[model samples]
Structures are given as structure tokens and as C-alpha cells.
Target: MIASFPYLIVGLLFLFGLYAVVFERNLIKIAIGISVIEAATNMFLIVLGYRTGGRIPVFTLAGESKVLVLPTPQALTLTAIVIGMATTALMLSLIMVLYRHYGTLDVREIRRLRG
Candidate 1:
């Protein structure tokens, strides 16, 4: 029962993020929503590593052993970080160019290349 709670929370986060992305009018909000969803997915991955009787992940030079919480999620989170950074930078750069030309940040106002 305890383990199921995290999954439920993660699911709710995913739903909220979905709603934010689909309903938000501002581009920035959409980006933030995507980020939230990504983070929730990452959390779910991390939670998958927990065990009922698992020990700590710390290791000593003397050969003391422990259960690793899960390195895959941590690695994936790093990847997500890089992706999120790149996406945000690209989005902001695009927004800046739009603002410079249109004198506004509203996505609806920038209609130069629309066929």
C-alpha cells in the first residue's frame, strides 16, 4: 500500500502537467508544464528502486556493502537535465527573436512566417 502512493502522486503530476501544457496560452507556461511532467517521470523511475528490506547505498573502502537505490534514474535525470536546458534555451532564444521583431512576447502576436 505504501509503495502505491508514490505512483499515484506521480500519475497526478503527469495529469496536471498535461493539463498545463494543453490549456496554457503562454509559451513559457507550456515549457514549464513539460518540465514538470519530465520531473515526475524521473521521480517515478527513482522510486522503482526501493525495496522493502533494502539497505543503504553507501559503500566503504573496507568492503562494507549496501543496496544501491538505483543509478539508472539518476543517470536518466542527468540526461533530462541536459535536454531541458537545451529546450529552454532554444525556446527563450526563439521568443527573444520574436519579441525583437514584433515588440511583444505573446505567441499569437508573432505571425510573420505563418502561411
Candidate 2:
């Protein structure tokens, strides 16, 4: 039970983000929710790669440790962070454009104004 605490946190974080995305009416809030989901994913990747008494996977910098944590998840998490930043930026930009066009941040209002 204690060993699985991190996984439990990840599940909770994902659920919170999903709730915000589904129930929030404000564009900014929805964008923030998406970011939270991305964060949860990044954290999950890191947690998945963590090992007790394991050293970093850098051969040149690592000491004499037989057990090394996998580096692939870390690399993938870094890539996801970069991509998530770009995606969030794009989402915010679009939200700004919508606000300028509709004069409101509410998703329902924007939809109504579209027609």
C-alpha cells in the first residue's frame, strides 16, 4: 500500500484535471486543466522510472552502481514537457483570439455567438 502511494496521487491528479476540463465554463480554466493533465502525465513517467537504490543511467558521471534507473522515461518526459508547453501556448493564443472576437471567455457564450 505504501509503495503505491505515488501511483494513487497520479490517478487523483488526472481525475481532478478531467473534472475541471469537463465542468469549467471559462476558457482559461479549461486551458489550465489541460496543463494539469499534462503535468500528471509527466509525473507518472518519472514515478514509473524511479527505483530504490538505483543510480542515474549516465555511464560517464555515474559511480560504481550495478543498478541504474531507466533513462528512457526521463527523456520522454522532457520531450512531453516541451510539446505540452507549445500546445498550451497555442491554446491560450486561440482563447485570446476568441475573447477578442466574442468579448467573453465562457465556452457556451462563445458557441452561442458563433451563430
Q: Of the candidates shown, which would achieve the greatest lDDT relative to the real structure?
A: 2
Please provide, for model 1 over 10-110, each residue's C-alpha lDDT reduced to its tens digit, 9 standing for 90 to 100.
99999999998898767777777887898788778777766665554554432445445555666787787788788778877886776677787555656
Clashes of each: 0, 0
Candidate 2 per-residue C-alpha lDDT over 1-115 given as tens digits, one digit per residue, 9 for 90 to 100: 9999999999999999999999999999999999999999999999999999888887666666567898999999999999999999999999999999999999999888887
**In model 2, what lDDT does residue 8 have?**
95
Which pairs of residues collide in candidate 1? none
Residue 47, candidate 1: Cα error in Å is 1.4
lDDT values of the candidates? Answer: 0.74, 0.94
Off by over 4 Å in 1: 56-67, 111-115
- TM per candidate comes to 0.74, 0.94
Number of the predicted model whose TM-score against the real structure is largest: 2
